[model samples]
Target: MRLYWTMPDELRIHYKNVLQKYNEEFTKGNLSVAWRHLERAHILGQPWPREHNYVHWLMLKFGIHIKDKKEIIGQIPRLLIGGIKVSLRRTAS
Candidate 1:
């Protein structure tokens, strides 16, 4: 969900660590690992505002050839408002 203020320091650090891991995986051409890390980050529920920003940064960082970053980001609103659900879709077909 979309947090609108600063995240807790611990959660922020956790997210950054996840981002770093994701970037490392990307550099190694390990898309699967990157996806797994991103998914984990998403489930961590750190905070809304920072989490939204992180997701955007992640999309830019990892979704170069994928055209659904905006759609994926949009889901953040749903997540924030509705909580996690089984129907969440990160990529647009």
Candidate 2:
């Protein structure tokens, strides 16, 4: 989606932090974490986040409008690789 507003450097920083947390929670398959981050981001004045952001949050929050096939299936193997990195660190410990 298109960003509708231009703000101060601080707001930009907040946006980046929110986006980062969103990615972190999304990759961990934690919808609650994702939603909270979005809420916080919105409170901080971020706008029109993104399709993936809203889609994943809605799927968890209300469990509605989740019907339809999408063209982008996401990178599962990438997630698997990230998981492997964590697993390897755990095994080492």
Candidate 3:
């Protein structure tokens, strides 16, 4: 999905709000909520893999690097499995 960078002011505002909420959720240890907001941010931003800002920020947030097509694909299953394992451990304890 390609989102034009020339988004409306309202959409930009909404995006910023979502980002703030995402950060808040992360700080509060709400990984699921944070992930939801991050997903929304990714959709709204439509960041290209080569975009430095997006890639850097996402890497900082998720602790994963996507330096190439292969790296991006490799991260999918790892992220899912890690998320599931974390969720299960959270629930079990």
Deviating ranges (above 4 Å) for candidate 3? 1-5, 47-56, 64-93
Q: After superposition, how far is residue 11 of candidate 1 from its true place, in Å?
A: 1.3
Candidate 1 global Cα RMSD: 8.5
* TM-scores of all predicted structures: 0.56, 0.44, 0.51
Model 2 over residues 28-65: C-alpha lDDT tens digits?
87867876775676555423323234433433332332
Which tens-of-lDDT digit does each residue in 2-92 have in candidate 3?
2323546766687778788977987887877877887787666542222223423553545442235664565566444544443444445
**lDDT per prediction?**
0.61, 0.49, 0.55
Error of 2 at 48 (Å): 9.2
Clashes of 3: 0
List where candidate 2 sits over 4 angstroms from the true fold. Answer: 1-4, 46-93
How big is the positional error of residue 31 in model 2, measured in Å on the Cα after superposition?
A: 0.9
Q: Which ranking of candidates, highest lDDT first?
A: 1, 3, 2
Worst 10 residues of 2 by lDDT: 64-73
> 5-61, model 1: which lDDT tens digit per residue?
455788878877987898798789798898788877776543453475456556554
Candidate 2 at residue 47, lDDT? 33
Candidate of highest TM-score: 1
